[model samples]
Target chain A: MAYSNEVRDSFSKELDGIREAGLFKEERWIKSPQAADIEVEFPAGAEGKKVINFCANNYLGLSNHPDVVEAARIGLGTRGYGLSSVRFICGTQDIHGHLEHRLTEFLGTEDTLLFPSCMDANAGVFEAILGDQDIMIADRLVHASIVDGMRLCKAMRDTYKHSNMEHLEEKLQDHQDKRIRLIITDGVFSMDGDLAKLDEIVALAEKYDAMVFVDDSHASGFIGKTGRGTHEHCGVLSQIDIITTTLGKALGGASGGCVSGRKELVELCRQRARPYLFSNTVAPVIVSGAIKVLDLVSATTERRDKLEWNTKFWRDGLVKMGLDIKAGDSPIVPVMLYNAKLAQDMARDLYEEGIYVVGFFFPVVAKGQARIRTQLSAAHDQHHLEKGLEAFAKVADKYGILGKSKKEIKEMYGL
Target chain B: MEEYKKAILEYVIKEYLEDDEDEEITYDTELISGGIVDSFSMVSLKRFLENKYDIQIPDADASPEAFDSVDKIAALVVRFKQA
Candidate 1:
């Protein structure tokens, strides 16, 4: 056997515990492509259902756009499918260089390096730069990829209060004895849809002489007026030291990531970053499609404007219905349920009503902070928004979450 | 000891609850396990307590077990202060 009986028994017991604790994650299969509306394969006795998708990262609704799809098809015909070799060993192509250059231009950075995924980009950056002489101070709510990346490095690590600039300043002061200090944060916190105060962070970095790195995964393509990112929204695009983002979310809803920064850093990462040098480069289809996505988003702000308007409309509607929504301007709106069972029940009820959203609870978030995260897309029309609101109202009424004051809701839910 | 306990509990409530006056809490309430205080919050609390009490929390005592409740956290503070 691959494992001893004792070990296997322990593993089975752990899985049992997870199942009993209501923490077992079950994957729901989708039959159609990712978009505002998708066909989901239901379990036995239930036929496949087409539902309004409110949980995907398809913010700009360009994932399955006809133009992007056509671009990918042409790219596959021109460049073929897989690289079958790493970038150093015959993988770098003209399209890849074009994508990197376009990203650097779009992000207002000096250079950019591509990777298989944003997670890999994050995984490779920290270890490639920081060492024992450096110290890293990160926000408490940074993505798990960054936490793993920092762990792989030899730098002394400290986490400050989430979005608490004062706490960060104190940590920077405490670590002033280190040779170098790096401050890291996410451009937009996904769970809460809150933007980091990058302008303030940049000022503090200057004051403390620390380098700043931001993972702009959640805000790259459609955040600011021109859709630059948190840096643009916060007015510190030129001040950030390094930026890591993804093509997986707002760019194309495909899988790829990039690290954009100074020319020296990009050159260094190309030469030394393990994931970039060892792994196969991004697929031609994803690359070409992502390039098209950038062009489409940058050329016009119609999709971005529509997404923002839809988010505001839906968020205001939820609030008007007395739902306790987390306060933010990002399209990711979290309807706070407080109780795990209630969140799950609400998600199921909404799904039955033809609205698709996912419930998030403990481990993914803090305990007692259960919520239904609804992501808005430009693809959703006014009719879809109204229908989603109607579904939310019905579900909220059924759960006794409507018209109750925040206090009453908390008391009734035992929160 | 009473001062230390009061200070620690107040900080936890303010940090985690964001000064929300609606949620009632007590010193004996479970902090780490009950999820009122997560790992991230624990890091902030640890740093604050270390600075305020002038003590170092050893690596062995950094688990949720050490700072599970207000009472346990107070005791750890006292022990560290004495050490």
Candidate 2:
């Protein structure tokens, strides 16, 4: 049956409004594997070209690594492709249990439970645990998944100012009469790459008798001394109550996530969380790939060191070139370009110059906070960084965003 | 009453109008529908009003329609202050 004309017109009109406001999201096609340099097929049927990828979540560059590929191949041979049912219903395999145990050890948690994605882990945890007598206070800048999770819970919900401990304190005190309080935050805010002050949050949690939860999706497998994530980085690994992170980012860039924390909480999620209880078990290949990534990252800090070096190199180069880059240590660096149209144009120009990056604007961020978010990878060597820098310099020069004379740019970039 | 409006306007300007300093924020400036105020800003506004007026705003009343414009928020403040 077809929808009525009124409904069709309303939907089409809203879409038109989105397009007019430049908020429409367009997906770019990548024809090759996830890597530092990739073959990108243009939207207009243009010839595909190898471009330096600065937008992928392939932080440790294990997405297409030889060892990771071989592990997946072996997994296919030994563990099979998938289990068509949920974990409790004949989906649990030896590899699944092994991966869960490996994650628990790696994250330094008492136990762990896997989900289809960190998104599911986040969405399912709140409703399963919290009730009307509880209060959930979250950072306003947390990922949308957290917001949806909070909405599903039967708790008194409040959002503090982004990274504002004072506001968080106010909300915590406001709802102190509640039976339980849960503080939710993203370990590293994705758009700006700013780290949450976990030490302060832990202190507040202790004072208020609240549990702290950190979604370390963007920080896992590459942050801290041994790549254990924000809790480790903040020196509060033992204090954090719950941690939800993805294997899709630095951990091989495949598809799986887990909730790792206190043993009882993890067991509760395994039994009660809707996503884990209802969704199909994670594929054997991704589980094998994730285990391999953990082993590789744990054995040596070489890849993370390279990623740190590349991030500093690229971020410092952009700064030296007079770009308004946000100050942070994370590999996710955002170069501010205020205007939405300008950000979109810059991304297009960067792509034409053989550098792949994406523009973020409101409502992905606050209004007037448009930027080009460039994610660095360990696979990016010195030459790759130089080439990407050259492309960025050229694009900025063309658009006058470099804010420097031609001679100055050449001297600074040695172009 | 004017004092309440002034405080809210000042807060909005100090926070959201960093880039658009020249743009004026009047009483009927459409804070919610126009997207000048978002979820984060709305909560801040709610807290500011609650603290300043010494009133409690129930969760059901903490909505966009209840405080879409400065006039509506001003009315809400008056209603609660009287109650």
Candidate 3:
């Protein structure tokens, strides 16, 4: 056989080692649509259990919105399902241009270019814009996709302390001899739910002649007062040089992303970005739904307001219960458990209580920072949240982790 | 300064390599390239040194090369302390 027994045994042993290390991830089957309440089946062949989902990135709860679904259906009928060619070829449709225009206006950017996903956008953007002479100084806690993108480019990669403007300034000063300096960060950190200090970053960037790049995947649909993005939230909407975001989360929960920023930069990506140049164009259904998503979010702030209220309510509840949670304003609340096994056990118990959550441990986060990352959504009503809080309280009580701080938990669990 | 090295080594072992009880870490042990300390841990380690020494180490001097070992980290802290 082409695949030898030795190689197969080695792979099996590796899998066994991962399981032994309590790091093997098993996927739960979701029979229902992505929403607040989902029917999940664990252990492969078991019966599905209905649970309230608290682990999805569905911030605005537009994933199964009826209107957006109808818009996608209309698009399917009018434009068909897939585009077999790349954008430069025959895949460029009128709807694609229309969606890009709408996104540009919605994000308050000069121009926009669509990509297959935000991962692809990050992967292709750096190599297209920067060369060996340039330097990319990123926040240490930037998303993994940005790291991959930085690796693909020839620019020298450096990092500053997370959200430390002084560190960022020092790095910028050190890189002044380079041709260009780009400061990259996430608008809202996904794990900690903390908002980036864009105002401070922009000030330092201006002082040092460095450009700013923000990946607003977690903050795009419902962050600012008017729900534009973190740039608008930080009062620097037009000042950002590059902003990349996804349509897969709060914006219709479909698969598409874009790089929006200065016209010249976007034009460069359109011409030279490998993902956009070589990969197939985004499907018409996703584009049509994303257009409707922009329309919905732009027309009113009802869903965004609901999401903000939900986040506040959930956070306040968790705090009142004395659970050790990350302090932040975004909806991604991480309840610290410190020990990886304890986090996993607590998540399993929470699942048993009909509240769906996942344990995040080392590799996903830092060592000794294991947590249950609960994401609130606009779809969750007061009743759902109350029940979810009750489930959490019960599970925390069972784990004897209520009111325990991080240090205390570590001392207790031996992290 | 020797105390600083000992404290740094203790913190690294307690925080980053706690699960590996058998792993031996000295002042000259590789922390970054050996994968014992990742970027995230390095941030916290920097913060720990800053808080412990009450000194500001500029990001230019906080590179992984400067933090690859307990001795290097102690030297960086002492430099900031005397500055």
Candidate 4:
């Protein structure tokens, strides 16, 4: 009686509607470790096919590095597996402190505080800092985590057009009456793969006497000249007030995130962020692995350089084939398909051709803006790029969409 | 101004409410709160208006309340045009 048939029937009908609309997402089971080439089996139990993965956030190919794995093993042997308590309790391990300091030094921030994930860091940071007298002015295209975090806080929320410095400045001028005005933006937008105008944003914040916060989750590794992140790339390394980034992506691709920023703000989060106070601490294994990742990136920019070259090569290849792609300098590249069904069909066809990339459609993006988002990594060599290009060309040819613009695609397949 | 309202109405119906053919929309129809348009769509709509009118609408005047209906959107546009 608690779970009634009527409720179940309504839920079932909604799920069916999603499938009929071509919006139902199906997971492809990966049999091997996270890598550029992974064995995937779709529709659940079929045979696994090895495909060149172009949809992962593994920018530096450090996900399965031998040194990182060895460091994790050592951490497990030394620090044990899981912490039963939170950071304020018995969860504070020596390695945790070491990782925090290491991240502070790596990110060029005054201090850092670890979280279960970047999502948690974002969720807790806003509420920990701002109050009702303040306002949070964010970029419209900032990560969803930031949106949720702002909702949890009592501060007034407003958003400027994505990367529009003029609009941001106007918003800043509008909110001069507030006790504090916080400008929030992603260092790099994940879906569009576009970097934020952090230098302009920093200048605006300075002029308006506002605080600047950046969630560098997508740009934490292999983004700048030396991989210090967007702040470093924008020449505002010490000007940002708060920075939240993830260890989940290019930093060994295990799982951990942190808020690295001003010493007082970081201390405030450590003392007040609910997730840090209540949730279990990040595993020592992840912490140790992240330490190794920071050390590797700090030691040399070889992986970062390789990833940059791979992104350029892949982007040039796609462009040469006359496919419309979102213009970005990052490793994340999206091939614009426009229609949801076309994107889904193209992703399926590309999968059959031994390429692993996901179709992003409505809800994930705007209506009529569906695309196949492809990410490149240092692990992807010239051979992988060539093979990926071949597979994409075949798929594009199959759809007869080569050289077609978004308008043309929309006209062909109704969005 | 009436022409602006008509253009805004036509664009909203064609671009946003295309999937819901049965739904009726008018100059006073609720767009954001009624779920006919989302934040992303609103941003694009704002961009459309700016591009069409060749006027920059300040973010302060581009609130959800100001853009909830075609009549309100047109009024905002006129305010910017006059400014």
Candidate 5:
């Protein structure tokens, strides 16, 4: 047992290969709380206190919000820490009920059911609702969870071209006579930051007697008046049948998900969903914190507005830098670098300069579509945004990505 | 009938696998843990088995002991035919 041979040696060998290729994920231990500015403890700071953290999913500047933290603590005191049972089996708390009901009202749905995560919320939905006789049509670039869900279901599945309504209509027409047809898509595409054309999807649903489902993981808690989701963004909130979202992304970055939809569908999912019936319920503190988040979203318009302003400002700045930032209003801005090595190298250079961002290429996106996915946060002030952009420009110029000098760049654009 | 079973096994191999060289499977060979058909793909292949043989692979008939390998799958089919 002491002699390393098969499994352990194989693991080390594989990891060494990854290390050689510069692909090993070196997870930094974050020391400080998730705040506007963060601190990470690394081995390099042996003699001195050195810290850095620029990559985080806490977009709305609320990870360290006093009120949200207090709400979580209060709920922990009032209702224990975790239930440790499924929602249907002695795990349903009053706060969970209140959150579900409030979310239903907030999203203009008749009912809602919480899940372990938004991934599960999307994953468990298909097999619960659709069966052998049903058909599921989805956008080509919908999230992985939706694709996995369809795989579990015995539905006739077809993927339309990404955000291409014409191709979606073609698939819908082909499946017009199916017993049930469900059209699914992501509201704000996570990779390119482009939005789904929900208005056309809604019209197609109506024309073909099909229902619509949207995994609004990226769109919820922002992107519209009152921050409903893609449906709200497209002014087709009433047409979408099933609207599922996560608490982890925008709703205070907690650990849960919920599906807001018609009363029958929501109740049916509660009864039949695998995770809801088998897995443990979310902790009471997380739910209570999520409730506070919903309240914050409803009461003040500050968070989402700030996020919108940041997105536009950053997108415009990156485009001006001549790095070919994908055109979109969503906060998931992909600054295109085209080659995998170039994208990864750029990410490394940016990290060294104290700006944390991640490079995504194949198989996350298509080959030759490599990009540095710079996620914007409401926590980032104008100064931080400007400094980050300037750092990006300086590094990008240093890497010779801008093709010529900044004077030539400005002159070419006539700025 | 045995020939039909062989053909069905070969067909399952051809359909599930990516390469024809990978399709050199005996009727008695194991396919599940051999990593040919996954759980989700098993559902579709089960549909094909039922349709091709005109036999419903019942829930009780779909246990690991009977459907775990292609040999076991064939044995289960023969047992069903006798019943």
Candidate 6:
């Protein structure tokens, strides 16, 4: 059953616009677990044929790690499967406590608490500490989950332009008397893969009498020395007031999120965060597995170092190819193709050549900044990075992007 | 007012353009919709307006309207400064 025919048709019209705009996303059925090279197939009913996988959040190559897989199995054997209850009500397990403590220690924070996803880690935060009297000034480019969380609170919400500490201070200038003035930003912006200038933000926070909040989902498992997050990368881990991160990326390539910060904030989220109180507990196997993942991260920097090397190789190669890649040093390499159609065409071509990456255009990034976002991981070898770079260069040259780069296009457009 | 006007225009062009080539682009040329400025530079422009010029912009003003062209951005800057 569906809505009335008129209403149904009305929604379809907008969806058709999405298709026309080339933003209509369709998922391909994956025939294998996520990895550097994925195999995906369309069912018999669909129009497209089988394709290799390229887009996944698994940055550490651990989604299918034998050791991680074994840990999941062992946890299941010892702890059983799902917990039907939420954390407050019969959902908390001994492993949950252990994992939280490990994350806290690893992050060099006072405490930590888990969420079903990084999205909820953000969703739970604003309402937990912010109230009608509080004020939050966020970076304009923070993730959607943070926006949703802000909506749930009554605090006065403001946005500073991405990474602009001066603008953040200007926004904070008027709120000098609020009960709380907090600055929130994504530690590493997910789309462009640029890092938030935490040192500057911390200075602004101190000058303006505000607390700091950062979501380290994209940066947590790979950027810093010990893979701690932007805090470590910024070398200001102790100055920030709050840090939220994900286990879904470089950690274990499974789903879980957490907030690590002052013991009070962690305790506050545990008791007052709606999702934590209402959502079902994460599967026991996932928690236990994540505990082991944290331990592995604590033990070595091999994977993290590989990730940095791989990122430099890819970023530098794309630049040498005369492509317009964003300048941020983070692992996210956006090969800019301003035209949406060109971005899509490039992505389609890359898929055909067995390279997996996604094209991001308007609404995700600003219009006319359309790009192919290439995420590099420890899982990628030198050969993999070189192959991806070579494939990108070939496709870019074929599209007239090599000799006539995004720079030339900007020159013509006066932008 | 005159210096603010010049600096704002220069900043907009510098943020929009890759190589700081010309200074005569019209004030009303579209920045976002005309594809002169994308998300990254739009952000840079916002910071320029806020910090260098002391103008306050709401999140909603991030659209093409305020940043559409030199004139529109100048107008936005003036209105924000006056306010």
Candidate 2 chain A: worst 10 consecutive residues by lDDT?
A: A406-415
- The digit string of per-residue lDDT tens for model 1 on A130-156 reads 789998889878998988888788887
Model 3 chain A: weakest 10-residue lDDT segment is: A158-167
Q: How many clashes show up per model?
A: 0, 0, 0, 0, 0, 7
Interface C-alpha root-mean-square deviation, candidates in order: 3.3, 4.1, 7.7, 7.6, 8.1, 7.3
A109-165: candidate 3 lDDT, tens digit per residue: 999999999999999999999999998988877899998898899987777767877
Candidate 6 residue pairs in clash (backbone atoms < 3 Å):
A38-A53, A54-A356, A415-B16, A415-B17, B27-B70, B27-B71, B31-B68
Best by lDDT: 3
Candidate 4 lDDT by residue in tens digits, A1-415: 6679999999999999998877777777899999989999887889999999999999999999999999999999999999899989899999999999999998999999999999999999999999999989888678888888988998877777678787788778978999999999999899999999999999999999999999998888788899989999899998899999999999988888999999999999998999888899999999999999999999999999999999999999999999999898999899989888888889889888899989998788866678999999999999999999999999999888999876687778877
Considering just the first chain, candidate 6 attains a TM-score of 0.94
DockQ of each: 0.32, 0.32, 0.09, 0.09, 0.04, 0.12
Structural similarity to truth (TM-score) of each candidate: 0.92, 0.91, 0.88, 0.88, 0.79, 0.83
Clashing pairs in 1: none
CA lDDT for candidate 5: 0.77
Best of the two (1, 2) by TM-score? 1
Please identify model 3 stretches exceeding 4 Å from their true place. B1-30, B33-83
Clashing pairs in 3: none
Candidate achieving higher TM-score, 3 or 5: 3
**Which residue segments of model 1 deviate by more than 4 Å?**
A4-7, B1-17, B21-64, B70-83
Over the stretch A1-415, how does candidate 6's per-residue lDDT look in tens digits? 5689999899999999989877788876766777776666643355444433335667677778888889999999999998789999899889999988898888888889999988898899889987889888888779878888887887877666677666677778967878999999999998878999998888888888899999998887777888888999998987778898888887887898988898898889988999888898888899978988877778888888887887788878887888888898787778877777778889988877768778888778765677888887777778777778778888887776785666685554422
lDDT of 1: 0.88
Q: Compared to the true structure, candidate 3 yields what TM-score?
A: 0.88
lDDT at B45 for candidate 1?
A: 76
Model 3: how far residue A304 lies from native, Å: 0.6
